[model samples]
Target: MTDQLTYLLQKLDASAHRYAELDKYYEGRQPLAFLSPEARTALGSRFGRMASNIPRLAVTALAERLRITGFSDPALWADWVRCDLDQTSGTAHREALLLGDAYVIVWADRLGRPAVSVESAKQVTVMTDPGTRQITAAVKRWEDRIAKTSTAVLYEPDRITRLVANQIGAVGSGFKVVDEIANPLGTVPVVRLHNSDRILDRHWHSEFDGRGHSEIDDLIPLVDALNKSLADLMTTSEYVGRPRRWATGIELTEEPVLDEDGNETGETVEVNPLPESHRMMISESPDSKFGQLQAADLQGYEASVRVILGQIMAVSTLPAHYVGVFTDNPASADALRAAEASLTARAEARQATFGRSWEQVAKLMIAVRDGRDPQLIDDVRVQWADAATRSVAQEADAVVKLHQAGLLPVSTALAKLGYSADEIAEIRVARRAEALDTAGLDLGRPA
Candidate 1:
């Protein structure tokens, strides 16, 4: 189970990366649809042809790779897509709950009142003295009343015993503890509700809406509604049609002047300082925008992925969505297939690398710990050198760029070869000294 779960996480990570890649490719969009002739013409035939399939291919491929249920079920997958769109629109509405309390129906005749006499009234109270505090509650009734009403008391020992005994029956050996006024230690009793039949006449309704409604019915619509709501909210949430990326309000409307005369000069212009009202406003905060988008995407993506993976793990057969997915759009179909392949490869590679690296790091640590482990140190050093060479070859440009930036940690150079922290630190300390005659420092310069 752990291995399977780990595989799934790695798969999820790869799927996320692919999604991000495709998002960049298409500049963030949904699946394409059949364009009207005029719309296609305006976009140009090639543009219309390729551009339309981008989202479908990306999302479909990601789903297929994730092995979600809808992959085999087109209709179900379509619903899921609709679900995604619905969630994206962000129409969130709260659900209302029904609350109720337990009540009893008493017989007016038993209480010495005529059933037809509506004017007469009767009242009864149940009280319990817990020794620390006394709780009292009253039930009021009118003669000839046929409906039910509620009377609540603190859930004291007597009330609970009564409710339980009334509901379950007094047959079993049951006991309860009650607080005593004199002795703080408390007292126990083999007890039961005195008037079980009388109490049983009342029905206990959950105080909150306890209607057993299908969550699927509620959740699907809710997610769709939330997406719609979000779409509407976004349109009004921020400054729309502003020229500057992060500019808002008057600052966006105001033009910069090159000179005091306000002439249209080619020289650099100094814009007026932002007004007080919009002073703190920014056109866009990359961090905030990125974070929000990521969070929203994460929620929907995670839910969809979980559902898909669950189906894949449970069923021996693939869903119809998986088959119909190919027919949806060719480009997307290809992408989806590729995404599936990519996810599997990534998961396998991550598992293999993690295990291998952990072992290498451990061995290096042991080698550095004591001076007599030269062979072990040499073996690990050889492995690190081979890995480094492959890494450089795979992405030399990225490596050079990273080296140029101070962003790469000082420890990275020492640790990149898979040395343990202590091992790396010991090397650094020894290297800085005048001369290292120590046994641990002679790894022959980290390759």
Candidate 2:
């Protein structure tokens, strides 16, 4: 038991650094950390850790779109509501997007219902079976940095074990079993929300044990480039973006004398120093003529910024508008839809993956409710809200066009426009009643 717990703890310790680093990037602190001391001086003391934060925008855009409205089963949906998952699940989704993984732990509460807890990747780690890719063991671990102690719970197929060790962040810190419970649930109750998980054949994240990847991996380099461009622009604006004035022929003399009695104190200075360029600086000398130094052309800097932003948009799968990029011309409907295509595809992909994990959570909740493993409700499905980006008017117009072309029935068109089954049923009943009323009125009128 000691050896097994030690192994999981060691794995968790190894992964914690990665989780913290990703979190820093998602919070917009990573780019500025790389700023050289000279760059910081150039940026000014007032500016500390300022960057574009487009990575956060990218992560947030996808996380907000992956909404779980409910489950297909009423009982499961009810359980979800009881757990307040509709609100709490957003945290889980965001953490997964930021950290490459998140965890949902389900256990029986005192009320005989499932209790749900959300955990960041730093707090949890799992051992997966190579052939089946199933979690054979999982751990939720916590540490007190000041106290230098670690407390953890390990979930295996047939038992739950709690272990604690002092001298955390040290080598060979042994963990002793503090408590144990036999598992009647028959399987691990921890569900992982792993972002960008890839099959071993196609996996590229060899650095972190070939585990799941994250949006940060694609965004960080782009963000750094973008920040560099922004910083350059700022520097140019501060020092050399605008024109400087020169007056070589000016006869301005250096003399200064000031006292209450008008005595010469002999502190020499330019007779009339250069005034702000916003106003005229007329020299008294007949030959005095002002020449302007050419300002640095900022167009190229702006173009570089846009180019880096384009790269960011491409890598993050975010539309231009999401990163606050837009053209002089208002975006056409087709253009808007085209821009959102990749983003919509990414959201749907997440739904398909995160939905599987949510389904397992529902099953685990059912296990808690029934006091046994949920082998019966294997077909549980998660109902996700539509992540497609389109205005209602546009969708309605498309539906009408499809109906007019005889390509889609009214019901199917309504479904395409995101009507629920119950809402469609109600509409059908109301339409039938209206038709009957019209027929009765026609019969009574003159036929």
Candidate 3:
């Protein structure tokens, strides 16, 4: 059952992706609004009259053909919400999704004045029977056509409470996203795509066994299952593609800002003395040290791996030993611990403050000494990842790299690194030109 579930999920996911691709290509090339009346007539004449009652294709039907029943429409959303809600209790459960009553108000004037007076309000409720748990939605529309502006809600016991917590995290916490996985079925594809972030190593495992009993008895196997799922799906999809043009490497190689004696003068953030050719393009070359490397080259992967290693290395630092050593000791351990602590502090600060930690800082520091802000290094990684995901072909693996490294926020990270958003945009354009040049393709031809 599990194996079958996994296979079905993969098929569904792949099918959905194919459909999305078709939708995008069709939408771009053929816009309903852009069609002239003559063209419309011509098409109609050729293909017969358009059906007014062209039935909406059921997602289940689509998924069935694609072999992805688990991810089909109401089944996907309903199961996802249910699984997610099951993880919470009390307020969290309520806040995540609430079910209650909502009133739809309509204004009407019987006397024929400038505005309509209050006519009537209809009460709507989403309720589930305690005995049967058969959920039903009840709504009373004012007119035969039903009020278009009417608002309806489900009275899930705990959604509102969860929403409040999420709101607080968004406002008070510096982090941008707080994601959790709730997998009711182990072999589902949506769980993999919706959660399993590569950087954080977060994935979903069934909380209960196949028979619906708690599977938390041994946490190891569950965690291993989740990890295995992530590993399997790691390189299957790309959110964006790499640039199309050939990149001849960065210019401005003379170290532009050197003094008469050629000693380092400006701060790390100071403009690189190199000309346009040597200028760093975060979008093209996220690993600043190797600006023009191909996406196929292991440079990005190696760089990301190094960043993760750095964080892991930093974890070895101990504060207690470093804080009290004073005798005529070599203090090698203390020194190492302090350095690690500094790195750890910086990483934790970045993660806690913004949900993203600078995994590329150590790699960038190797390119130039004096410890530049990890934000700058991170920005370059993100921009490159974004470019790859957005531009590269769907089959390309660049999207997987970006998604795995959690480097999609390159522009924002660059902004934090002291580059204005506009400057970053210009840099992206230039980098895109280089990548496209390298790939022997044109960047401006539409997308």
Candidate 4:
């Protein structure tokens, strides 16, 4: 038991560090410290200053795009879990996208009714068995600064252990077990939703197994470059507008002055310096031809920044037109579709991983509500919104063609055209009602 607790504590600390690193990037802070002056300025004479500015544009853009393309629709699956999700603030999906993972904890409320809630990665950590790669326990650690206390809720397969510590850092107070309750679900009540998965011996193999990488990791360099390029451009602009100059044939003059006591005092000196503002400085001779320091050609820097942004889009699988400014005509539908193909693929990949977690959450909700194991709800699947960018006319034509070819039913085609199951069912019922009304007969009456 001691070993297990120690292992979980170690894993929790590691996960916390990973989360902090990712969070730093998300918050527009540099995750890595600037290199030493000796290393960065090795070839100092010719090169410019080190690019140390931290910009969050790439992280912000990637995260926003992922949230829009990945989890814009929370209740994509059209199931009982949707109800539970709706009961929350409807930010569970957004949290998952931002944090790379989110947690759902299922339990019974005061009325003994099943309830579900979301937990950010910062507050929750999970420990998985090495051999099975299955979650053995989950911990919810939170600090109450106002109350000057820290609480840890350890959820195991059969029971929940709540531990409280008076001082925050003094974990040695040894988590005093305040309460223990039997887990009715008979399994870990927490489900982990991951953004992506990694292979074994790798970082992220299972749902609760790894610290999934955030979408912003790859775009950090590009974002830094973009910011630096912009800074250089601004510097160039300032230099061009107010060129620096040097004054020549100017000398300092000193003259002795009388003091208040009528005695010879220190000499008063006059030192003439070049004008500091953006005005012409008068020179004594034609030899002093106000020379301007060469301002960098900003065109190259601007173009390089654009290129970096393009690379960011390409590597992140986001559409170029979406992130970059478009001066030319808007891209055609086919062109747009081609551009978004990679983004669609990425969204699909995320769906596959997050979907399983949603399924588990749904099953847990069912188990809580019905007092059943919910093993029968295996078929409960997540319904993802269409990730592709297509015009309505194009989608309608394709659906029509599929229906004409007898490859899909009309209802199924409509569903494929982005209609939810509930909406489709309602449409079908309305059509049936209209048909019955047209027949001028009530099915309940014996006409």
Candidate models: Cα lDDT each: 0.29, 0.78, 0.27, 0.64
Q: Cα deviation in Å at residue 430, candidate 2?
A: 14
- Model 2 poorest ten-residue lDDT run: 201-210
Estimate, for each residue in 1-447, the C-alpha lDDT of model 2 and write its tens digit: 556666766777777667777777778777454567787887875455658888788888998888776566666666676777877899999888887788899988888888988887787878778788878788888878898897888899899988778867532356677899997888888888888647752234333244567777888877877777777777787778888877767665787767889888978777646756448776677887878899888899889988888888788788878777767223687777788889999999999988888988888888888876666666788877678878889889988998999999987776677765556667999999999999999999964
Ranked by TM-score from best down, the candidates are 2, 4, 1, 3
lDDT of 3: 0.27
Q: Write the per-residue lDDT of candidate 3 for residues 212-260, one digit (tens) a residue.
A: 1111112223222322232222331221123223334433334335578
Query: What TM-scores do the predictions have?
Result: 0.15, 0.79, 0.14, 0.74
Q: Give the runs in model 3 whose Cα sits over 4 Å from its true position.
A: 1-125, 133-137, 140-273, 276-447
Is candidate 2 or 3 superior in lDDT?
Answer: 2
State which candidate, 1 or 3, has the greater lDDT: 1
User: 3 or 4, which is superior by lDDT?
Assistant: 4
Cα displacement (angstroms), candidate 1, residue 30, comes to 27
Backbone clashes in model 2, listed as residue pairs: none
In angstroms, the error of model 2 at 267 is 11
Give the per-residue lDDT of model 1 (tens digit) for 232-349: 2332233232223333243334454456786756645446444535536444435432111211223453355344433432231222244233333325444544434433453233
Candidate with the greatest TM-score versus the true structure: 2
lDDT of 2: 0.78
Q: Rank the candidates by lDDT, best first.
A: 2, 4, 1, 3
* Residues 320-351 of candidate 4: C-alpha lDDT, one tens digit per residue: 66665575325698888887787777766766
